[model samples]
Target: MDSQQPKQPKVLWLNVIVFTVTFAVAAIGTPLWAWHHGFDLAQFIMLGVAFTFTGMSITAGYHRLWSHKAYEANSVLKVIFALGGAFAIQNSILHWASDHRIHHRHVDDNDVDPYSANRGFWYSHIGWMLRDYQRNRYADYTNCRDLQKDKIVMWQHKYYLPLVLLTNFGIPLVFGVLHGDIWGALILIGFTRLVLNHHTTFFINSLAHIWGKQPYTNKNSARDNGFLALLTFGEGYHNFHHIFENDYRNGIHWWQFDPTKWLIKAGSWVGLTTKLRITPEERIEKAKATMLLTRLKTRLSVSDENQRRIQLIQFEYDALLARMTDYYAMKKRFFDLKKRRLLKKYERADLLNQLQKMKSELQQQRKTWYSLAASYSY
Candidate 1:
C-alpha cells in the first residue's frame, strides 16, 4: 500500500502538540518578545551553548556512537551525552538507535523504514512522527541490544521524561533567571533553539534525500550536501554516510565541515573517546572510481566514437586500481611489520622507501586516469 493512501494511523497527539506549540513559540513568540524586550548577549551565548550540546549529542553520541558504533567513549563522556540527548528531546537512545538501524536496514522500503524518504517530503520529514506508524515496534527495541547493555543508555531511557523536562525547561529558566531575563532565555535557548534543531535534523530525512549530489553511489536516495552538513553538525555527507555507515567520520576529507567528527577525535586526546572507526581508503577510493566509471560508461555508450573512449578509460582505470591495490597492500604490510617490531632497521627503511614510491606512483596514475576521462568530449 502506498504511504500516500494507506489506512490512516492514529495521530500521536502529544508529538503533534509539542511540535506545533514549540514551532509557534519559536516562530511567533520569539519575534514578539524581541520586539518588546531585545535579546541580550547572555541569551545569545546560552543559545549557542545549548544548541551545540544537543546537536553534538545527537550527531556524535546518538548517531555515530550508538547507532553505528563508529567510536567508543568513556563513562564520563557517555553520561554527558545521555544528558545532552535528553536535552535534544529526540527520544531515548534505545528508541532512536533502533529506528535508525531499521531505517538503514530497509532504507527505501516504505513499509519497513521508519522514515523512508520515498514516501514524499512531508511524510519522511514530520508526517511519520505525527502518527503511530510503528506502534507495534514502539516498545520492541531488539535492534538496540548493544545500547541496552550500556548503563548510561538504559539510565537515560528510564529517566528520559524527567531529564527532558529539566533540560528543556528547567535549565532555560535557570539561565533566564541568572541573566535577569527569564523570558529571553526561554525564547532563545528553549524554544527557538529546539525549533531550529528539529527542522535541521528533519532536513537530513527530507531535503537530504531530495537535494544534493550523489558522488559516492546512487544505490539509495542519500546525497552529499555540504550546506546541509553545516546545519546538521556534519551529517550532510549522506551519500558517503550510507555507503560507509560505520565510519566515525561522515565528511572524510579534512576540509569538510564535520564538527562531530572533530569533537570525537578531540575526545580521544583527553581519553574521553577511543577506537574511532574509519573505512579503508582503498575501499572508499574504489567505490568512488566504480561509481564514476559506471556513470562514464553510461555516457560513452551513446555513440560509437564515445564507445571507443570507454576502452581507453577502462584501461586507465584498471591501471589506477592496480596501483592503488599495490600501494595500500605495501602500506598495510609496512605498518603491520612495524607494529610487530620484528623488522630490522634496514628492512623497515627499505619498506618505507618502497611504500613512498608506490604512493607517488599511485598519485600519478590517479591524475592520469582522471585526465583521460576528461580528455574525451561528450
Candidate 2:
C-alpha cells in the first residue's frame, strides 16, 4: 500500500504526545522541579540505562539478528533484545525490518526507498516519517516470513505500541518515582535521550549516504564514514554494508570498533548463534579489486600508472580466487570423507590433518594478495 497525503494515525499520535510531552516536560518541568528542590542525579542514571539498552538492541537485536539475520539468537536473548529495542521507541522489529529490506532492495528509488537519498537530506532524515507517507508504508510480509515465524518478533510486533510506551515512558517514571524526581526522569531519560537516539540511528540513513568514501560499489549511494561509524556502533560503514550485506560484520577490519559484531561473536561462545556467515576473504579481495579498477578508471585520464595498477589488481584477484577454490574443495572433500563416520578412527583423524594444511595455504594466499595490493598502492 502506498502512503497518501492523509495523516498517519499512529505516528501522528506518537509525534504529538511523545514529542510534545517530552519537550514540554523537559523545558517546563525540569526547571520547576529544580527550583523547588536541590540538584539530583536520578534522571541521568535513567538516561544511561536507556542509552545502553536501546542502543544495543538496535545494533545487535533489530538490525543484525532480525533484519540482517547475521546470526540467530536464543529465545531469552530475543525477548531481551526486543524489550531493549522497544525502549528506543523505534518501530517494531517487523515494521523496521520490512522497511529496511525494501530500502536495500530499492534504495534511492523515489517511490519505494523510504528515505531515498536522491530526495535530499531533509527528506531522508526524519521528514519521511513526519508526513503520512501512507503510500510506502505497507510492509511486504513475504520478505519477513522468517521473522513472522518467530514468536518474540510477533509478540513485539503485535504489542508494539504499549511496549514502546512502557520502555520509553513507564520505565523512566518508575525510576523517577523511586528517586523522587519525576520531571528529571521525563526530561533527561525520556525526551533528551530519545532525541539523541533518533539522530544517531537516522544518521546512517541520511548523513551516511551524503558523505564519505564509496570505496566499494559505486552502484549505490552508500558510503563508508569512519567518524560516523564511531557514533553508530559501526553502521557508519554504509558503503561496505550495501555491498556486502550478508557479512556478519560491518567493520571488517580489526581496528574498526563494531560492538554489534563483537556482541554477536561473544554470544556464539554461549551457543546462542550458529552458522554465522561471513563473506569469504576471496570475495572481499574481489571487492577491493573492483574498487581498484574504479579508482583506476577515474584516474586513467590523469595518471600514468592507471592501466598497470588495474591490470595488476585484476591478475592478483583472479589468482587469489583460483587458490581459494582449490583450498575449499580440498577442505570440503576431507571433511566429507571424515563425516561419513564409517571411516576408521585413525583414517578420519588423518583427513583432519590434511584439511589443516589446506587452511594454512589459504591463509598464506590471503597474505600474498594483501601484500601485493599494499605494495603497489601509492
Candidate 3:
C-alpha cells in the first residue's frame, strides 16, 4: 500500500481574488479616478495619518505585543491595536501572531516557515498567501496560546470580517462624505493606502531577509536594512529581531528609525504599556565579538599562509576570546550586584564598591580585547 502524503491544494481563490482586485484598484483604478476627480489636501492628509496608525498598529501592537509578548499593554491600547490591525487588514491578531510565531520558530525552513525566504522572494513576499500549501500550519495555535487568552484578540478574530469592512470601507466612506469627495477619499485613502501598507510590510519578509548586513548572527537569513526600516516603521532591523526576539525594539540604536519602539516607550509614560524587555548590552556586544572572531577564524583557516603567520593569528584570537569572556562575566556580575542594591539597601555601600572594582576590570579587559582584535588586518 502507498503511504505517500497527498499534495495540498495550490490555489486559494479568495485570497488570490481579493489581492488581485485590491492591487488592480490601487494601481489602475485609483490613479485614473484621482486624475478625473482631483483629490483634496484633506484626503491626502487623511491617507498619511491613517497609513501611519495602521502600520504602527501592526508593528507595535500585533508584531511586538501579541506575537512576541515583548511588552504588556493596557486594555485601551490593546483595543486600539486590535482596531488598527483590523484596519490594516493583515488578518486577526490571533492568526497573525500564530503565523509569525511559526515563522520565527522555523525560520529559513522551507517546510515549516510560513514565509521562508528560502522558497524565493515571491513566495515569502506574497505568494505564500495565494496558496493553501501551508493549510494545516496554523490550525493549532500552540505557540500563540497566550494571545488566545486576550479578550480583545479573540474578539477581533471572531468579528474580523466585519471589522475589516467597517475600517476599510466605512471609514473611507464616512471621511469621503465629510470631505464632500466620496470617490476621491475612497480611491486615495482606501485603495491606495492599503496597497502601500501591504507591500511595505511584505518587503520585510522578502527584501529584509535578502538584503542588508547580518551583524548579529548568520545562522538565519534575516538581515538589517535601514532603508527597509524607513518603509516598514523600523521592522527592517530583521537581523537583531531574529536573534533577540523578545527585545521591544527592533532598531537597538537611538537613530535607527524605529517608530514602533518610540510609540511603545511613549505608551509606558502614560501607563499604557509596561515591562518593555531589552537585551543586555553585554550580551549584544558578545554576540558581535563572537561573530567577528568566527569570521576571522574561517578566513584564516582557508588562507594558504605559512605556519608561523597562522599560529600568530590563532594565538592573538585565542587571547581576544579569553578577554571577551572575562569582560562579559565581570559585566554580568556588576549588573547583578546593581540589581540587588535595589532590594537590599543595607548592602548598597559594599555593592557599589564591588561594582566600581568590577567596572574597572571589565574596562581593562575590553580595552585589551579590542586592541588585540584590531591588530589583525582582516
lDDT digits (tens) for residues 174-235 of candidate 3: 99888898877888888899989999999999999999998889999999999999999999
What tens-digit string does per-residue lDDT give for candidate 2 at 192-262? 77776777898999999999988788898999999988887888989989988877799999898788888
Compare the candidates by lDDT and give the number of the best one. Answer: 1
TM-score of each: 0.96, 0.79, 0.89
Query: What is the per-residue lDDT of model 1 for residues 1-378, given as tens digits with 9 covering 90 to 100?
Result: 646766889999999999999999999999999999999787888888999999999999999999999999999998999899898899999999999999999998999999999999999999999999998896658888778889999999999999999999998998888889887888899999999888999999999998998888989999999999999999999999999999999999999999999999999999999999989999999989888888888766557787678888889899999999999999999889889998999999999999999999999999998887776635
Better of 1 and 2 by TM-score: 1
User: After superposing candidate 1, which stretches have Cα over 4 Å from the reference?
Assistant: 1-6, 376-378
Candidate 2 least-lDDT 10 residues: 6-15
What is candidate 2's TM-score against the reference? 0.79
Error of 2 at 181 (Å): 1.9
Candidate 1: deviation at residue 99, Å? 0.7
Clashes of each: 0, 6, 0
lDDT of 1: 0.92
